[model samples]
Target: MTQLSSNQFIRNLTIQDIDDCIILESKGFPPEQRCSPENCRYRLSVASNICLGLFETTPLGDSKLIGHILATKIATERITEAGMGKRIQGVENSGHFENSRNIGIHSVVIDPEYRGVHLGHIFLTKYIEYIRQLKLADKILIINKESLIPFYSKVGFENLGLTDCRFAGLIDYDMVYNL
Candidate 1:
């Protein structure tokens, strides 16, 4: 697979990315597994600093958001439906917990054309490094399908076993990468 060109790079996402994010999100997740438009905006408004996006610069100098990892700060070790849902305790409608110790990764999406190019792996590694540098959270958590456990494991995430959190009737494994 071809790699991203030199002009492409990863940066924190902005509210302006919501449209691209929504489009890419639909392509990446199942209906029930997808974050709704409201929640996407909430995550960005509350924690845009952790919403990492991989963008490719076009020949005209405009940037296209191709991939993103949307995360939220929470106190829970294991992810809950509420955590992944639009709102959760301590996450006020207007703001998020400033001292949340754990970072819950809600989504990881790449444009359909960008798949199979190792962009997910590269993006994830860079995310971990970026989070670690900030020292904002003690751990980074994610709930993923069994098929992806190995992929996440490759990025130093340890599978803590099956979780009670069910979405789209698929079994999910709770994984974590300690910073």
Candidate 2:
């Protein structure tokens, strides 16, 4: 695995960065987990937070986009009065987000050649930090299966409980991180 120099910087993702992100996702994830181009663009366009491209200046006209991470708003209604997270404090139902105060980590992908460079950590730190700064959402959540729990745990997420996130009978964990 190759390592990048320490001077690299992560910048806000833009529409132009979608292709690179798609390529990285295709390489880093299995087909079942990969998002389609339309979905990716919609997500990138609407996310409250997006961190893409760890890069440095070049002699050429622009910097290169090296990595990407995208987080979208997660909206859930308080269906159960006894539920632990029933009352979401600061969330708004802006139509884009369906219900309460939460953000969903949709995707995190790094260029395959740059995996060992800690770019993933750098990208995640930037995303989480931005939300922290804004004080926007009370919690962050993700839906993933058992096999990816270890990786998500390393980044401060915990298994809050199980969710009915089934795709053709496959189940997923409801992971959360309190911000």
For TM-score, the strongest prediction is 1
Per-residue accuracy of model 1 over 36-138 as CA lDDT, tens digit each: 8998998898899999999999899999888999988865777876676565456633234558888989899888888888889888998998999988789
All candidates: CA RMSD (Å): 2.7, 6.4
How well does model 2 score by local distance difference test? 0.64
What are the TM-scores, per candidate, against the unseen true structure?
Answer: 0.91, 0.73
TM-score, predicted candidate 2 vs. hidden true structure: 0.73
Error in Å for residue 175 of model 2: 1.1
Model 1 Cα displacement at 105 (Å)? 0.2
Stretches of candidate 2 off by over 4 Å are 1-4, 51-53, 56-62, 77-95, 98-100, 167-169
Model 1 residue 8 distance off true place after TM-score fit, in angstroms: 0.7
What range of 10 consecutive residues in model 1 has the weakest lDDT sum?
88-97
